[model samples]
Target: MDSLFLVLPLLLSASFPHFTSAHNTAPPPCHFQAIFNFGDSNSDTGGLSAAFGQAAPPNGETFFHRPVGRYCDGRLVVDFIAKSLGLPYLSAFLDALGSNFSHGANFATAGSTIRPQNTTLHQSGFSPISLNVQWYEFNDFQRRSKIIRERGGVFRDLLPKEDAFSRGLYTFDIGQNDLTSGYFLNMTPGEVKAYIPDVISQFIAVIKDLYNHGARSFWIHNTGPAGCLPYVLTKVPVTAGQIDKYGCASPFNEVARHFNVKLKSAVAKLRRSLPKAALTYVDIYSIKLNLFQNATRHGFEHPLRACCGHGGKYNWNKDHGCGSTVTVKGRQVVVGKSCKDPSKAVVWDGVHFTEAANKFIFDRIVNGDYSDPPVPLRFACYRH
Candidate 1:
């Protein structure tokens, strides 16, 4: 595990120097020259700091040698997905230092919602950037890409609007925050259930926006087991019986499944409208659930607890969240604490997954084991 701290930084630094220089990578058999991602922190490579502020420490301490704006301790699921497809890790389009637009640009933000003014979440200060804003940002990115293509810029000189975009894979890993935030706003399970159709409509709208721009390859990840998350458990009342054998809140997980059912149906509707598009809905919830069931076999000792955080049953104290600060002994101290080994834990910071978990999930999705229609991204992108 100690080797992770040493080896990962060297590997990442040696490869991603393009924030300051030009670079190019040959497309794999998938024929996807690039990836353009849009969502929340679940798949945000660095959208937080790129457009807003930075992610605090313990966030990337496990691997990247620093916080790279991902909510996790290291790489996100999108990072692993890119690697699986033999592509460079995607860069946030809003990154001020410059991201490698050649491989792809991420438009996801940490606190994004599917709606522009989702009243429940918005009232609770949870709606920082919505999917609506992300689409607008994508439009701006397309504009910039066009200018760069026309001018024959310093980076990825061969990529033009049609050459790179037409063959690129567009991925989304969002909607978890949109649902979870409703609980914080005091919305009941019934209320939350009623709101699923709105979420589906918004997702369809975003997909249509991308389809109009010549994008045909789509890999969309459904929300994972949010009820199983350690931090979320702290937010609500529960009985011992309510906790499942896997240590997740049964009622909350049911809500997630319910949402997925509606979302999956919506994907079917989208397919009928955009028949030529390759839309693969990945079942992230099942992938994560199976991982929880086989945690010991997968090298995770504490699958329910976070690798970083403080003072809670799951090590995710709400009063002292991961990367937060508190005054201790007349000095400012980081409130959260990190585990002895992060690679052995599935959860990170109570809410997000550890790098190890995200990699496992990505592997399952790419392998066709966890994706709906049993189609892997390799074949899905080729159809486009």
Candidate 2:
């Protein structure tokens, strides 16, 4: 943990060599009243957990001090975004218990994809709540919240104001699953590449739908380096030659890069069509890929290993995943346990990043170092 503080400065300096006091010195030019996030496990607060079951122990042990429906040991990148904007953590749209949608609601569920899979969660380990489904949830929430607020009383405080839809920031961190799902089904990288256009088209449709519903600011994150994730490394078959020096599967990363390129181009086209909207295409792939390639430099270790998994070369096993239990010699024991120090680890589970790592990525992107048009998160409402 001490190493984090020491190397964090270096990490920040390396991200933006022109880093100055002026960056943090400036105040936010505009205010985003709320944030409506849509994605998968990377930014999911509680949607999947609420519908299925809670993510087991050690999941939210870092910052929240208990399991709070986040995949990370503490908070996701979205949580940091809320804190930075002085807003409260977003409630999941599907979670009815102890929720406050006054600021905004998260429609992201773990294992979600841009294109809906035909298989069930038990069959494919993917969520039924696709990007389009999330858009529908948001559409419903937007309409019903206004109706309920008209009655006033306690309900008014629990839901967002009508104007919040237009003033809120719409964020997306999906598409990684769309690529991996194909791989899991034994499809070639070429096959996955073939469907990317359709996936991206669906994504654009949702953004346009949101725009029609009055969302003016969009903070869209292109998917991260799927090849660098332990989940992919363990699940997918790969030739040693396909693996890069960084211990990532080169072919998979190439596909991910291809997806990002298409997504960026789509976002650029969306900007011209939706003239009123401020669309920021954040290059999360580069940021995460760089972190994996230079893990030790950022005070992290085992870039390709899961901090909370049972056993394997990457400490990941599909059958006995993170939080899995087993009876060893007639005694029940938790096989998948967290590392001693999550701060020193980049990945938490095989699929998700630790809170420490999320914070690291968030800090860099908040300065617009990885975003298009070079606009900070504070001024994302402005179209460059």
Clashing pairs in 1: none
Which one is best on lDDT?
2
* RMSD, one per candidate, in order: 8.8, 5.1
Query: Candidate 2, TM-score vs. the true structure?
Result: 0.93
Q: Rate the local accuracy (lDDT) of all candidates.
A: 0.77, 0.90
Worst 10 residues of 2 by lDDT: 19-28
| Residue-wise C-alpha lDDT for candidate 2, range 1-384, written one tens digit per residue | 344445544544443345425443332355888999999999999999999999998889989888888998998999999999999999999998999999999999999999999999999999999999999999999999999999999899999999999999999999999999999999999999999999999999999999999999999999999999999998899999999998999989999999999999999999899989989999999889989999999999988999999898999999888888999999989999999899999999999999989988998898777889666687788765
For residue 223, what is the lDDT in candidate 2?
Answer: 90
Query: Which residue pairs show backbone clashes in model 2?
Result: none
Off by over 4 Å in 2: 1-28
Ten contiguous residues minimizing lDDT sum, candidate 1: 18-27
RMSD of 1: 8.8
